[model samples]
Target: MREHNRTIAHPGTREEQMANQQGNQAQGATKKRRTFLGYLALMGPAFVVGAWQFGPGNLTTAVQAGSRFDYTLVWVIAVSTILMIFFTDMSVRLGISTPTSLITSIKGHLGKWIGVLAGFGVFGITLMFSVGNAVGSGLGLSLIFGGSPVLWTVVCTAAVGFVLAFRNVYGIVEKALLVIVVLMGLAFIASTVVAQPDWYRAMSGMVPSLPPGSEILIVALVGTNFSINAAFYTSYGVKEHRRTRSDYRDITLVDTIPGIVAPGIMTVLVIMVAAAVLGKTGAEAGTIGALASVFTPLAGPTGAMVFALGLSGAAFSSMIANATAGGTMISDALGRGAKAGSPTARIFTGVILAFGLAVTLTFQASPVGLIVIAQSLTVLIAPLLGVLIVIMANKTSLMGDLRNKWWQNLFGAIGLIAIIASSIRLITTLLG
Candidate 1:
């Protein structure tokens, strides 16, 4: 055969070149779709973590703050929410970088007893707080459907039990929470608009001030919004999602923004509505009934209904998340898996849910008191957890390149100081 030289055109014939271009476009589109879905999956855990703050406990506290002090305490929500973003970011980093649960990490670095104590504290906090969720759910149902709060509590408990029992419970929970969050946003935003708050006062409220006797309300606001258990749960939630170290980059931090911001916005709306209606009238909202009344002046009967719906959504979503946090933490503490759908997780979740139901039915405690008490108690335990997380995040061995930078450490320290101060104040208030 004669020697031959051949040169291949980049894409061969024009038809072949067009086909190749089409194929490339198709691949690009597929890649974009995959990335979009990955982002959505990453959002699941953070959204759940954020939605946890919108519970009935928070609702009660925000209502009290708004009704009692108008926008005077809105600064607390802003400050607490900013701290939430920092802590939650640390959680995401921990979850993506570490191979074990936060408790296990603490045990490895700190004393075993310290880790054990922290675990127990988280469980206790979750258990006590679950009561607020149950009561809040029941109160919401009673407000909307006109039933016994106790009866509605049992029904809501059962519904949560059914969801937790599912094999794909985390998926169900994320979707459920996302829907509930949307419902809450709509309800609160609509109510806020209807109330037509004085924008001047609302804006000025962003400036920090200590109204007389407002210390307790400020603690409640901070404690509920910047929850320690929710922060710890963020680690497990990220673990449940099975994100790799590569996912721990800035994108991870970005994903948490919506989760943090949504609940803050909801809290603000609730407060604005309360300030407009209840504060203007100097009416008290120490009870769920009174809270609902604040909404009535905003949109009449429909406003009450909307408020109840938002409250129900917050209660139910928080119920699921609170149980999951308790179950996941307790299960991890016992050396079982922390995955949301594990047998141990489900069992522990049911136990917490049952306990909450029993308490709500037996005591019939005031919803506001229940929330304030549960949230205040967290102050004692959360600082320990926050300190541990900050310490862990600073460990180069654990976090490698993703460890807390100087600014992160500075903010973390500030947050810790604020938390400790609030906790001391809470204890003092309780003691006096």
Candidate 2:
């Protein structure tokens, strides 16, 4: 038999039209996926900073703010987050502009001592953070597993040390922290949903009240939420990822704003939840256990578990970022190296971990106090870092087109004043 002619649909035929629509849909889907992945690729450095900021210390202050003052302190988180985005954006620009790490660039533009001092200052702040991280990691695990907080602290520290001991440390740290931040966000959001916080009152909390006797808690909240040191570290992350000036805008949109805001929103949610569940009954969440317990009556065991998970995730992620940042900065300060995988950086990181463990073990009786104190102490050193970032970001020689605009400088100055005022308040509170 002869070959038969094959049937074909005309261009305007139903079959042909359906195929065209399907092709267009497939192309659209593919483009959307690629765009999302592009954003994901830019997500590392900022999320790591967010994880570091939202650690146990942040959780503690937010809990206290909610339990003690209800949502009246939510404005602190909101303001701090906005200021944080400005500082982080500056750092991102610096990262794209500088030829070396942030500290190294400081050494180049400022004095050597200033660079070393910035590094040491950051290291000192991280040391304070480590204490809270150690206590928090253990306490969170204990709340979930019914074990000694000290034991879990040890386990968490060791695990973090092992993770940091490897090569490509920044890459590992960035990816791990991104995952942790997402999980922490979900847990807090879920807990908030269960708590059914008072929406009207919570909104009113955004009106900015001092609420007599809220000084220390407010200081701690700003310390953990604004976190100039964390913002300072963002430049290092940008350098590590080899980002360029062209990538700056995208980084701010995808990474910096969301990364910083994630923790801030979570903090606000925590405050709202605590106000609803704990403040109403005048129950104080003085410890992680206490915080978790507040959730139990409102949503039962599941609620407590969710809060615990968020706490544990925050602690663990902060533990990693805190140690890594301390190690890297100190290493850069000492002229050893800027890479987290460097031998000197790793050594310093291990020392930070050990220091936190030692301090936690020594002061096992008053973890909540230690966390608040540690967090507040961070505010004292933050003014210097904030000033340094502002000065560096304004240098036209370095930042070129990416230098701080008038708006950035405006907010940067505001943030600096806020941090300095917090420092002064903390000093007076401690002395009194």
Candidate 3:
């Protein structure tokens, strides 16, 4: 009776072990599910950066690359993308470690003037990007709805302003961009499917080569694709999302790698489709309208409309991200505030929109020219931005354990070299 009572009181040790194991299994499953949901929640910042990076300028350049040079330049996009991921990753770490905005952190670590200059420099690049966004948005809408391009530009600008005017501006902008990127992704994927590019040749294009007269085009491709400024703004998005160190690994897996790579893949698809559809004919799709027309002949009116919608999505999404980034950064630079919804940031955003609109209206004759010039000009400021990101990420005191790994600095060095080389080429091109 005593032995039986003791057995009942304790159960068997094996039974207790079995029960604990089952409980742990259930807990592990729940923890994994929670972790997965956390990843979904962290998806915003990088996509926003991606949307900003793959704008009208990116589209125009990719189209030009495919149509004019065929697959020879695909390697440029490949290299730019790999380097971009490194720079953006560095920015992500900085965002998580720095106490305040990236610019503020720069002020703390680098110097007040350097931070201020970085802000203005980024703002300047955004101004150039805004020109492409304004023109592309106008042209894209006109292609879809059959309206005056200028009228659509104004409407789009006002619409963006309205979106920014809301409370929780960063949150609103992030969500809006997410939707745009999804739509753009679908449209491009479908377009690529219908266009039916040559698989073997497109794969071969992965090898880098410089076809004659491709220097300037290559510069434009690197400028738009590598896009150090877009990478720089990523930290702001990270800070806005309030990501912590615990969130870093998950964020990289779910957000940073995929987010940056998504656009790179889309850009590649665009190049392949263009090469298949237009390269053989030796026809150059220099402008957005010209690019859209190429799809119509290949896939009918529906295809054309699909491509136009993608363009509109790209332009509008970029407009929002670009202006918001510029405004927020500049405001932070001037000691206003870093948050997107801050009064000064909103006002500065409006100013950016207004500047783009005014420029588009005045220089309406050459939208494509504006895009190339604007994109090329960004390289002038890009080397500086790239250096700053690498420097900030390497600061042990500032970044703690999140500081850049050695491989990161190595890639960061390569990116700086690429940007500096592009800057030199662009200057020579301008001079020549």
Which one is best on TM-score? 3
Judge candidate 1 against the unseen true structure and give its global Cα lDDT, from 0 to 1.
0.80
How do the residues 362-391 of candidate 2 rate in per-residue lDDT, one tens digit apiece?
988875666556655575568889999999
Query: Candidates' TM-scores?
Result: 0.89, 0.89, 0.90
Q: What is the C-alpha lDDT of each candidate?
A: 0.80, 0.85, 0.85
> Regarding TM-score, does 1 or 2 come out ahead?
2
Off by over 4 Å in 3: 1-35, 279-283, 367-373
The per-residue C-alpha lDDT of model 3 at residue 407 equals: 88
For residues 214-237, could you state the per-residue lDDT of candidate 3 as single tens digits?
998998889888989989988998
**Which has the higher lDDT value, candidate number 1 or candidate number 2?**
2
Give the clashing pairs for model 2. none
> lDDT per residue, candidate 1, 224-339, as tens digits?
89886788788887877766555555345456888888899899888888888875566777655687876665568898898888899999999999898888888777778767
Q: Please identify model 2 stretches exceeding 4 Å from their true place.
A: 1-34, 279-282, 367-377
**What C-alpha lDDT, on a 0 to 100 scale, does residue 105 get in candidate 3?**
75
Model 1: residue 385 alpha-carbon error in angstroms: 0.3
lDDT value, residue 83 of candidate 2: 98
By summed lDDT, the worst window of 10 consecutive residues in model 3 runs over 24-33
